[model samples]
Target: MNCVKTIVCIAAVMGASANTALAQHTFSMSSEVERVENPLLTNISPGGVTVLRFAPTYAFESRGERYRSRLSLSAVIERTSDTTLLANRDFPSAGYTWGYAWPSSDLELRANLSESATRNTQFADFGRVTVDAREREFLTGARWNKEMTERTRLTLNATNRRVDYDTPLLEDYRELLLSSRVTWDHSETEAYYFEPSHSRLTPLNGGAVSTQTRWLVGTTRALSQEWSLDAFGGQSRVKGAQTETGTLGGVRLNYTGSRLTSGLEWSRDVAPIGAVSRYVRNELLGVRVGYRLTEGTSVAGRYSQSRSTDVATGRGSLFALSLDNQLAARWTSSVGVEERRSSGFGGLSGRGWAVRAGLVYSYASGL
Candidate 1:
């Protein structure tokens, strides 16, 4: 079957399979490219980077009265490049992920597994390069969510990770994390979610042991028809680690109107111990304006002004603008620009601009 037809079939089966006592399967695919106008190669220089990502996914959901099952599979490839690093240097990584969700009365069970492999080269000297090899990692986890009462809920999750490198210069590693959360929702508009998690990290050959204890709290409230707020705070203590304690807090104020949804947020976050997607203490004021230009097409403009007190080491100011046009019928297109300026601290600082334009084919009907 063709791609568009396949997508339509997959989405069509989702709702019915979830409600019926039958099982069903679905699939999806996506590709994306994000290029940097000027990348930072030596950690403090201007360079160019192009990141390409491709993903294919499959999902299955079933209902069996007292027993339920949901399965997901994903394959992804990620690659990054710098024309100056090695004249044509690039690193590619492939990863696969699987997830399962089941139901049992007031309790639900969930588990996920993932593995990834990476390969790349680095510049060491003016004429010398280090042939560091690929790195491979595996992760698996399970979680249990229980409804303690009509107003309260609790969850417990545990995960373990293992890592290996193709080069002996790099060593193996292992780690585990035990996390839990409890939430009390007075209603849809007002709620709080709290979490306490413990983690430990150690090298493959019993090299070093690092530990952490963390607590997080989240809250949401609707002030009025056009205004709402979301807030969260977290505290963590680390042992055998370079850092001692870290705390984080953030708040987002949102406004809605006939043609726009605007939000402003201020946040202070700590650096994760591992390679997780995160940023510094970021503050942002953003707006989204949507106009029904035509019966068949709609236009949206989004702009944001943000600042980052990179908790890791520096300060940065950024401005971003995105323009999107959607054919209420068949296609979607977007154009965006991002300009960044920062204080060159921690040896990582730059002033540059980047632009991107993309088009995506969508179903004639909503998915």
Candidate 2:
């Protein structure tokens, strides 16, 4: 059967097999306005954006399982000194997740799906591409977990994704991933794990097909009452016209306190370029910190950098920063900026920056 049919069947099976006991559902709505300094990440001309956003979410539980879904729609009106360059764009997206737990058998399962329609020029999940394009994407995944012993556990995961673009079809592709992990607890707050994964990629409009496999070992440790660390290293092998091997690894550190929270994340890996039907060497670093000023007020800041290189796409880099605030449980706001620089191949070279600020008002109801 086709992939889309397979996905629908899986969803149907999950819903039919779940218990029918009913539970309350939660619904919420939120709105935000954002301003950006650059609407397109290119060297053409500096632009800005005034963005209006609306989001709604619903959640429910049945028996011992839970399900949730959200939809977000937004309109972005450009703010450029040149009236000819000023235009408006709209985006709509939907996402959902279902989770089930079998405590008696030490098993848990989760499934997720999302669809998006947007004009935003950023990295897409399926491939690398030019910043200016009308894009649509569908992604879905499932995970299974089992606790074998008090000190051991196992997990299995799978995902499928597809992408489409109105411009060039460089980033349009379909992907399937299968992965497994085994964990051993060394102590109450420390554990080690080994993971193996495989991925298959097919270009939508007649490109070469490729498959990749990866293996990794990692450890997670609670360093202190308020701090924790996770690190991993691995290797990946990709089979296309020729076989290529590369290293992959990542590190994440987190801290939580009564009034503060912070994190550092870094990673380097060999993965699909997301724009073209190829693979690349990817590296990223990010840091974030948040502080609470009162019972319902908090502030946070974040920064991140990413670089990617492939034989097909050459190299590119992106940097971003943001500051956020939450007040009185119902009001939230953020300001963010981003820059992109690329020495791309196939006439994809470009550089530019964008900045944005927005506020959200939210309300929730329970049933």
Candidate 3:
């Protein structure tokens, strides 16, 4: 499989580069345990359930004056107490990511390739739960940036992604996206940009292909030393079995302080649902806040709500909070709580809550 091939390739590269003086390697392991009131957030679960998960990762990187390369491999193992729910069974998956960067005085190029597999959670978007489903994805992307002038710059980006499912309930699909942007520095504290992008999604199950095209104008302003704002307005057209045109826009505000960081965002966009092969218009609002209580301890929270503008598509909201503490130089501990609620989407609805605790240990060495 691709996962195995990725592991072998990364191992070979690491062996060949082990003798290099500037190579670095890192390895880390993490374990988490969680208790959920309803594991699947469905009526099928008889009672509360517990889940245990473990992950380990290895990374290698080599850098020079104007170029760099990085490789990473990881695996996940999960087990659950209840066997009734499809998600309750054991899940084992592996993945890898490779990236490269080349930079010069006026131009830069970057590329990345990755493959991963995990349990499908796209059902959560529609207030539904998956039944015996897993998703594997392959992604590749490239970016080019050039300085057109002292105050003007141009960037081009391309990405392709393929998604496959272990179960036939969800159809496999591939997406390709291309985009370009030109940025002008209006002042020391402000910048403006114009962007245009196109995307196509094709399903392997003989479903209608969907395409979207968008044009946008945006600006970024440094409101103050600690505050910044980004706003963009755009128009988008989506075509599939049916064609639709709509206004697309988003706004984001961020604040960075010595001990606190916060952000707020709202956007209207087109997104694809894995359960279905088409695209839907969605409006989303999100807020995140984080505070560093001490040098080694922090607390963060985030909340998001998404609503589909298309009829009967569904709406969902999620809230999560976590506390992280550095227990030692190479060890860390965290505890978190999450709540999710969803409705609509074929008349299915569910609400669930989960509490989790985790610990991580990491080690690094230079070759």
* TM-score for each of the candidates: 0.64, 0.78, 0.86
Q: Of the candidates numbered 2 and 3, which has the greater TM-score value?
A: 3
Q: Is candidate 1 or candidate 3 better by lDDT?
A: 3
Candidate 3, which ten residues in sequence have the lowest lDDT sum?
A: 104-113
- Each model's lDDT comes to 0.55, 0.64, 0.75
Q: How many Å off is the CA of 295 in candidate 2?
A: 2.9
| Cα RMSDs, all models | 8.0, 4.8, 3.4
Q: Point out where model 3 deviates above 4 Å.
A: 3-21, 43-46, 86-120, 123-132
Error of 3 at 40 (Å): 3.1
Prediction-by-prediction clash tally = 1, 8, 0
Please give the lDDT score at residue 42 for candidate 1. 28
Residue 355 in candidate 3 has what lDDT?
A: 98
The Cα error of candidate 1 at residue 352, in Å, is: 2.9
Q: What TM-score does candidate 2 get on C-alpha atoms? A: 0.78
User: Per-residue CA lDDT of candidate 3, range 260-337, in tens?
Assistant: 999999988787766676677878889999999999999999998877757437677889999999999999999999
Residue-wise C-alpha lDDT for candidate 2, range 1-367, written one tens digit per residue: 1433544455456656765555454555555555545344444546664555556554543443444322222333333344333344344444445665666233334333433333233442212335555555677777788888888899988888776766573467888999999999999999999999999988887878999999999999999999999999999999988798988999999999999999999888876644666666777777888887777566666666666666644344556666667755777776777665554456655565666666666655443
Summarize candidate 1's per-residue lDDT along 59-159 as a digit string, tens digits.
Answer: 66656554455555565565667534323322222222222344421344333444333211111011111222444555556667777888788888888
Candidate with the greatest TM-score versus the true structure: 3
